[model samples]
Target: MPAPLLSLTWTDHVTGRQGFLVVDRLVRGVCSGGLRMRPGCTLDEVTGLARGMTMKEALHYDPSARYVPLGGAKGGIDCDPRSPEAYGVLVRYLRAMRPYVEHYWTTGEDLGLNQDLVDKAAREAGLVSTIQAVHPLLEDETEARARLADAFAVRVDGLGLDELVGGCGVAEAVLAALDRAGHAHAGARVAVQGLGTMGGATARFLARAGLTVVAVADVRGTIANPAGLDVEALLAARDAHGGVDRAALRPGDRELPGEAWLSTEAEILVPAAVSYAIDEVNQQRITARWIAEAANMPVLPEAENLLAARGVTVLPDVVVNSGTNAWWWWTLFGDIGADPDEAFAHIRRSMRALVERTLGRAAADGTTPRAAAHALVADRLPEIADRFGWYATPRKDAP
Candidate 1:
């Protein structure tokens, strides 16, 4: 892969925690991704995530749709979000990055961070919005912002629409794969790692779709049961950080090692938490027929190769987790309204089509799904560039 277009590191003046930003590739003078705050985050990790965002944006390109996918960028801060100082570090980091956020990068929530908190910090950092950079692309910025704010306010079963769309996309990918394989969703066991925004919603959707959620791993440990755990109960009892309250566990639930989520007897494993969760060593324990990555880069390259050799299909994160990012643009650009039903319907249709196209190419090219996704992005980038040009020019007509 080529080096990122722009990269910078910022250290909080008070906390001394480091933050990194990488614009992997830019189209139309701006890029889109999210901000994640987690301890031990590194520049390399942020770079990988930015590149994934590039692929994600390209994969969702549709000439007919109103939403034009932007280029990719990401920001990460090396501090645990639960810490009291995390908020201050985020404010200082955003203040330091105010220039880029204003001119080139449009970011939101990712991983350890959420959109509300990011917006709050961005305001404290003297910005109009965390996504203010993309406002220039809007036909009517006021209408677009109102639509997005409304969409963000929409919720289903007490979960925000923004939080559930990505998981909905992942569930659709899983269902698409099952439909192609003639696998019945009824008895398919799914083990999910991470019970946060992505995982909780994914579990809810899958469980509603008739799949058995045999295990869910939070930061604490793995909660398992052979006969499907109560997903709704677990979700309701979940803390803001995504950890389930142990008191909510029903009888017959077993608490296993955190890594047990990998080896649990299940047809599918959804890793929705952290990157590099499955390395070469831990991969040998995964016996699932499919691993859908709800988190970015959860499976490293070598582990993916090993899993592929064993016929374990691994869906790339770019395809599986692209829904959330797509939904934001779809809402803001008027491709879809701030309606929960419309949003869910759009996500399902788009994700299913994307999965089918990606898997079909994988079979034809004799390559992994990740490679197939890369090829698709490679095909679309030039088309986007050809139409939009490499860089956007200054608009004389101002707001």
Candidate 2:
């Protein structure tokens, strides 16, 4: 991985709130990523996430190509999003980092932060709330472009554009994997861990595509039905209570232990929750033949190696969950006249292509898709750096 170009730490004097920003790589003097607020987010975590963002952006649509001029960066505020002081803390944090926000780093919401909270904080800080300035820069005069810009600007409050696009991308990747494995999508069973924004969206889209979402797990517990759980009911339950509502369980629905979602008998499993959900300890228990990472780094490096050894096709997060970054890139640099359906179709096509390419590379090289993805990005980065003159000159104290 390339070293970060800049690292900054700041604290709000009044609130004593602390945050860190890491610019992992920059292209054309611009970097973009997300701002996550959590209780124990560390500088190392933020730095790692920034590096992932760089790979995600570079390999989002096509691992063999670079689609956007933007680079990777990430910011994290060490505060509890559930606290009543979240709003105030966010405002203060954004104000403290206003110069960086405007000049170098543009961020949207991630993890504990929502679009509404981000917009409120950005407005409070007198900064543009939109993820990227789409309206003024877009040259297309089509009605679709205008609607897309409007939707991108508002982001539907809590749902957000990232969730919508990311979910669609995951579903698309699942289909691609299913095809590669010689399975049909309609009757295939899927187990999903984590029913938050990304997970919920993924479940919804997969169900819409005719896949049976046999099991879904949240922080509260896991719910399963061999015949297939009702995706609509589960989604409504999650929305109403922010998790699986045990009270809303239907006749055949059965609750299992939280970790049981991993062991469920299914063809496809999507871990869309926290980082390292499938670590060294539980990697042995994963029964699904295909693993599509809908969350960032859900499968640790060692765990992925074990899965690969077992002949389970593991799609890396950089490829499977890159729709958010791709959406942001398109909004910033793609053709503005694309309608929502057209835009989403493009995302699905791109993700499917990447899945096929990565799987092919893995087969040809006898490596896991994760490693193949890293090799592809590593191969492309140097050419981009040299062409754009972004190579960091060595310094005496750098190493």
Tens-digit lDDT track for model 2 on 1-399?
Answer: 547888888787867878899999876556778898878878888898898888886775333332444678899898888888878888888888787776667688787776667988899988874343322223442543455556565443245555578888999999998888788889789999988777888888899899999999987888999999998777767752247778789999999999999999999999987777898789898888999999777888888888888878888888898887777666555432234576678788889988898888888998888888887788777766775558333322235
Q: Give per-candidate clash totals.
A: 0, 0
lDDT of each: 0.94, 0.77
**Model 2 poorest 10 in a row by lDDT:** 132-141
lDDT of 1 by residue, 242-284 (tens): 9999999988999999999999999999999999999999999
Superposed model 1: Cα runs more than 4 Å off:
396-399
Q: Number of clashing pairs, model 2? A: 0
**Candidate 1 structure, TM-score to reference:** 0.98
List TM-scores for all candidates, in order. Answer: 0.98, 0.88
Most accurate candidate by lDDT: 1
